[model samples]
Target: MRDPLTVSGPEGPSFWAEHAWLGTHVEPGVVLDTGADGRITAVRTGVAAPPPGAVPLRGLTVPGLANAHSHAFHRALRGTVQTGAGTFWTWREVMYRVAARLTPDTYHALARAAYAEMALAGITAVGEFHYLHHGPDGTPYADPNAMGEALIEAARDAGIRITLLDTVYLHGGLTADGHQPLEGPQIRFGDGSADAWYERWTRLRERADGDRVTVGAAVHSVRAFAERDGYAAFAERTDGVPVHVHLSEQPAENEACLAVHGVTPAALLDRHGFWKPTTTAVHATHLTDDDIRILGASGAGVCMCPTTERDLADGIGPAAALQRAGSPLSLGSDSHAVIDLLEEARAMELDERLRTRTRGHWTAAALLRAASEDGHTALGRPGAGSLEPGAPADFTTVALDTVRTAGPVPGLAAEAVVFAATAADVRDVVVCGRTVVGGGVHRTVPDPAGELARAIAAVTT
Candidate 1:
């Protein structure tokens, strides 16, 4: 499954869209010109017809979707974990079993298939919240950063951009006593101490290129590290990079944090000066008012994984409230429960409607913004999610002629895309001026489903 998608040529490529959402509304007969560097040079609306030598995209085109959170290896557990009544804790036990079976080689295979699935779903960029470090028994491989590097390679092979959020997982669990020693499968995720994690991360970041893949730092969560200095040190080490952390996803996490620190997890992070402008709080599901205020005031973005949250019964997050308080909201397909950013976007609004028993909490355009521009911003791809001049030439077109989308007129095409379309509705995907998926099939990864089945078998059995 080597990459066959070509980047822009010396002449780049021209594409004409039947309709396109240019930031706010859908416009008809849109034309886009990409430069040699894979940046959009111009956008013309009302062209009515495709120019000569231009590829015609017959659908509602939107900016490339950004998957702000992902655990690629977890794709192996998709159908297997759906049985019986299980909590997140129980589901994690099964997940740990799969994690213990990974080698860097198998990981690359699995991640390649997982990322290719994301490509078919129209994801042009992904924020891999990676923590699978070291060997199975807590020993570093010949190359300590080998697992991290496999993810970078997998994204490249899938023809998508990735931000490797190299996470620090130093503790096994947080008990009332304090942080516990790394044990069992958890050991594979830890690096002895935060300083040691910093050393490995420093090396990875220095070697990581800024183009297709970049390195970012993560604290894992307050449960994994009670000490504040490690986070501070990591912040300094990854000064300009984005910092992401799992916030209060479950009520138990909030309880534990409050029991130990006398504050919410968000407040605890605030106390450590970890709330930088580029910081993103993943799954800020259970937050106090003060927690919301702190995140909003500190300019930290919130990434909501509604599909995964609902799947794991993690409860809905305060997305509209967070936005009202001044925090930007982004969507992520965390846990790979489903990689449809369109579903995630609508779930953000639909879940809110379920919670508040009201409607119109978020406009379709705002939800798309979260899945695109804001998500890219969270992943450190600033301004890469727009179709305007100077932005990266990355976009996906959804087929409005599909059974799920045929009723809507072109004027409300954006609404059809946001409210009706699924991943299957995406007919074409252009990333960095390259066609990764055309006509609902991956251009490079032949047999993504078969690849996924084989990769999962290698690990699970």
Candidate 2:
């Protein structure tokens, strides 16, 4: 008799994992059946060997990691800025220099390479926090949304899903004096006003392919979005879509928001009707008690980019407090400081340890959920990041035989994978039922490092 867990599909191959994380825990003898449409038709556990034609996955398979927040072009700055001692302000100067050099063609090359690197790290989907638009002189491209289209194409080329976060960057900077006009490199990032941003966003949305791409919106930050009128209208029009914003990543932003608006950035967003269930507040580092309450009460999620936060000297966010306050947690590799979600998952616990001098604030399962399920949810792919029937056939395998993951018992595999494993330990990656990476090598994009180097050089040189 056919197995009860088996179901009909488009005749795609099945996957049998030595161990697969079924949301809460790791289970051995797990088999995942994929249909022609790249969705899981059934999942069965405790199967002894690869069922008939099932491909064998010999590792701890988990849902494909979702990078919920990313600045794709920032990958060019990875090793270049580490030598200097600088604040986030100083780093922005360097980042702006790189941003100034990108055309749509160059941005596509860089993003494609960066997304390919992410695939190698087991990332099946990315939330690209894209803001660099127009030309170096602030003029719109011939197509207006050329830069955004490049990003969507980049993801398709990399064989991953993407939420093209079309960001609105209006003002140059905010101060007690009020909103400043766009200057120098800042000009390219602006769409003149929120209305213009929405106009372009609407066109981009209409053009976007819905199968593997999502059209989302973002408020660059309190500093960049000083005018409320445009974004308020934008908020109403963006129902049922994912919206992200930079909130209090640095104290300067909070101080500016308070000086001009007389409220925290979170409160300002809340006032503008930007805080909703589909919205996510990225960074959210220097939030107040009220900010925490606002985010949690609104059912909005928070994405923590631990490595980027540490690299930028941004203080640790109130992660556990936010989670306890009813906000779901998610993870991101923002800035690509490191592409590994495992490191991001563990750093949340470790950073909290440093701040409170306490241990075990989060369980391994919770961290995994944040990295996988919640991250996908934040990127507008609801019901993704799982191995259940009807979920996307997206998952990765981490070898238990690795030096770092050598000693955990079967039940404790999730903990070992989270705390001890790195991106280097990923053995296989399947996205939409397609094997993108196997034996730790990307199947399509050969020489990812070389591609990244060439792409970065095209922009930087």
Candidate 3:
């Protein structure tokens, strides 16, 4: 095996993969050339062998996976929250307890390790749906954006691209009576009002690098935002940025929205013109036909976190219907129940099969698109998640000879990967022409598991 750690010169780097997935199909003996600026300069296919000095990626190489939605701190709650019987609402309480323990230093430590684990899973970029602002008692730090900045820095150290979705979370929960005030750990997430939230978001935007780090915005959910007009104002002000919101993840949320706003969460957001091509709805698990039509017609995308949905008993989403209605689908590892995007990808199809009592609801290629290109687009990184020229030089090589991925023919390798392979099968990961993980080992953070253990212990214990 060639040393993946070797750096290429001023002209840039070239990688030759045994088999490469070119969006729709797999091609053998493909060479991808990257420019000095870290964009794919050329893709030369049908080459029988690696040219001199070309890095040899001996496996099925695919575009770097994009985790379209994540709550980085939630990684800490993985095993701790699984012990007892609970629903999504109950899960939220456990999650909030973990949230309350986070300081800026500990947040950065945990997120860095979490993102490094993502890198090991072939993820090159992540959409951090961050809302943990202020101190334990809702006090702003010296720099109000300190926690947000910590996450961005953590992603940088983890050698992955990050879109910090600076979230505006006001109120605690919605009820039949009205929006409730923040209580307990929930107080840490609010920024007083929409104006105050946007002010902090504006300052955070100034830190965006526009390449590896894109600053975006999100409303935690309709239940968390009582000021209805704030959604419209946020939409208008942050028009071009990637906007995300937690849609109807639970039936109770829909019931509350209907009682308070006389519409489902989807309809309520649509009334404020929140749906758009750039906006992505995370965990849109429950939707009426009208909700589907509204989201699809607006060309907004949906991100499904199947593992988290299943772990929390959130019902299977209408992924196929939403897709047919013209909404592009994306996948995420929300709550970090599992960090495998392939698992998230396959679970979406497998869950849909269980729901409709049918197979082939989605092709493996289509599922990979959700994990890759469409996901990157939802995170404000358009023109990524492909091996075509002018795209970012980001890709991961999955070991075909691994125990899980061994038997598939070259043509069906993509199917083998999406259906059978896990994060452990990822052998190498490259982002922006830089090697972050090689030979199944992360380069920057040498021991991700150890880091994760230490970091989680700090906040949890």
- Please give the clash total of every predicted structure, in order: 0, 1, 0
Summarize candidate 2's per-residue lDDT along 172-226 as a digit string, tens digits: 8889988888899999999887778888999999855554888999988888886
Model 3: residue 24 alpha-carbon error in angstroms: 2.1
- Model 1, 233-252: lDDT tens per residue? 67677778998999999998
**TM-score of each model, paired residue for residue:** 0.98, 0.97, 0.97
Q: In model 3, which regions exceed 4 Å deviation? A: 1-9
- Give per-residue CA lDDT, model 3, range 283-363, as digits (tens): 999999999999999999999999999999999999999999999999999899999999999999999989989899889
For each candidate in the order shown, give its overall lDDT on alpha carbons: 0.89, 0.89, 0.92
Clashing pairs in 2: 10-36
RMSD values, in order shown: 1.3, 3.9, 2.5
TM-score of model number 1: 0.98
Prediction 2 TM-score vs. true: 0.97
Better of 2 and 3 by TM-score: 3
